[model samples]
Target: MKATIERATLLKSLSHVQSVVERRNTIPILSNVLIEASADGAIKLMATDLDLQIVESISAQVEQAGATTISAHTLFDIARKLPEGSQVLLHAAEGKMLIQAGRARFNLSTLPRDDFPVIAEGDLPTSFELPAETLKQIIDKTRFAISTEETRYYLNGIYFHVSDEGQPVLKAAATDGHRLARVTVPRPDGADGMPGIIIPRKCIGELRKLLDEVEGSVAVSLSASKIRFGLGSAILTSKLIDGTFPDYSRVIPTGNDKLLKIDPRSFEEGVDRVATIATEKTRAVKMALDRDKITLSVTSPENGTAAEEVSGAFQGEGFEIGFNARYLLDILGQIDSDLVELHLADAAAPTLIRENDRSPALYVLMPMRV
Candidate 1:
């Protein structure tokens, strides 16, 4: 295989596909990327780690049509160090893959193309297209709540399903039994009959990073076992978690009457100030909501005590609740609105948090015993 590709273009595609290659692999072939240079002036790079895979293509000046396998990280590292605007030439022969850019050149070990495994592309019946901005919003708001605990594997990924309760909309939700975040976008066409799928946490992380540079819409297709996303020049396919996600709807509070409306920036700042005194173990901050003001305080036996006041609009008598400072910041960081609405029931009941925007999104927080 012989092809010449622009350094920037090759580096970008290499960055996309090399992330899927595991740093440590038991099988030698699993560490190498499958590079295929077609006669039609395109170079394809593919990498997989059994459960997840990424394939990306870039235009290249192909002199011969052939395929080869080389280390994903090694090629990316070499391409990344190449001078800007330089052209990269790739040549594979015998058992060595030669990479040349400007005056620098390196020969890397090659592996048999047949040793790489391909995730069977079975029929993915459900297909839809989601705007890149909408998908980014959903992932940004909900992924913070994805649990790290492996015991309940279902909580490790966002649950995506169409909720047609009052209005037909697509929802993405994640919860760690402490806080829950749910975001929505208008239901896309051709996804009404799709089953709920739990996209693994690792897959969501990678997809979110890719979407940072993606615009327009992403092609999404799924089955009971797998999910695929087609970004402009790249495609990602990942296996869905097999376990059943818990009934998350049952925990969302519906009748929280007490309302507290506050400036999100001011509230977040007050929480940060008070949380400085919070213990490292709990990182708990107490929110004492009153008829027009909220007193954020932290009292730790060892660290110290601190308090601050954030004024807001509240109708009910008063309410006091405690939450993890880190979790509060995570949820608050995702809110893009100036006003934040807190619907409260009691100290123990889950409190609902929503933004003051038309775009539908809500968060539920379980109080901590402070």
Candidate 2:
């Protein structure tokens, strides 16, 4: 297809779609992006890794109607390096896709568009829409907790399921053996009866990128085996994990009775400083909570020890607990609020963390015995 698209426009569209294409793929076509001209003055850029697919359209001037595929990463690099606001001319000729902009030209090898595997259409059992910001929030907060273990395939994704509370809720949960992150938001009107789906980790990462530019409501459609996220000019579709998510409700502790309110930034900083001396094997930062001061300490036989005291509001009796510093940093970085609340029962009990004054989100971290 011959289409004249602005460099910035093409780059923006490619930036989203090409990320779905793997840089190194055994199948030649899997690393390429399929470009096709629509009837109107819009061009469609599509990419897939077999498991996840992304399609984005950009306004362009179509001179000849056709379709071709080119290396996704190569095209992205070319577009990115081209001059800003430059007009990009693309055409299929001599079994190669020619990209021209300003004083630069590159001929990228082409593949048959038919070879690319597109996510087939399926009857979505349930459909609903939610604000893109909210959708991003759910994914961003809980995605870090997703298990990376390959043996337990079921735990490798964020589980989207309804909560046991009476009201409609959308919950995203992920757990490695070490820590768990569960976030809940009020469900939209039509999403009350939606079935649980475990969205794959790669799909969630791409979905998060798609949601970045989306400001309006994002349309969501899902079936028992697939889920689709549609933004204004972009769409992400993926196959859902078929296995069942474990009963996470039982793992979250409800008996934690101690409460501590502290500045999220200060708390994270203390953890970072104390963790400097933590052993690589443990990476654990120990917390000593007093009446109104919290001391973070870590000791390593090889690196010595470190201790830092941060002011906080604590009402419960003094207690100490060990936690993986990386996990604490991950959760703290995602929390936007200034103050954070932590509920604790004992040194070994799970710690419940919540953004102070915000009820829409809560985090639970299982403590380590030190």
Q: lDDT: which candidate is best?
A: 1
Candidate 1 pairs with clashing backbones: none
- lDDT by residue (1-370, candidate 1, tens digit) is 9999999999989888898899999998889999999999998899999999999988999999899899999889999899999999999999898999899989889997878888886989999999999999899889999999999898999999987867788989999899999988879999998999899999999899899888899999999899999999999999999988888889988998898899989989899988887777869899898888899999988877899999999979786889889988888888888899888888888888889546578899988887
lDDT of 1 at 142: 93
The most accurate candidate by TM-score is: 1
- Writing each residue's lDDT as its tens digit, candidate 2 over 51-136 gives 88888888899998889899999899999999998999999966798889988888878988878788895899788999988888
Give lDDT for model 2. Answer: 0.87
Candidate 2 error regions (>4 Å): 356-358
Q: lDDT for each of the candidates?
A: 0.90, 0.87
Off by over 4 Å in 1: 356-358
lDDT for position 61 in model 1 = 99
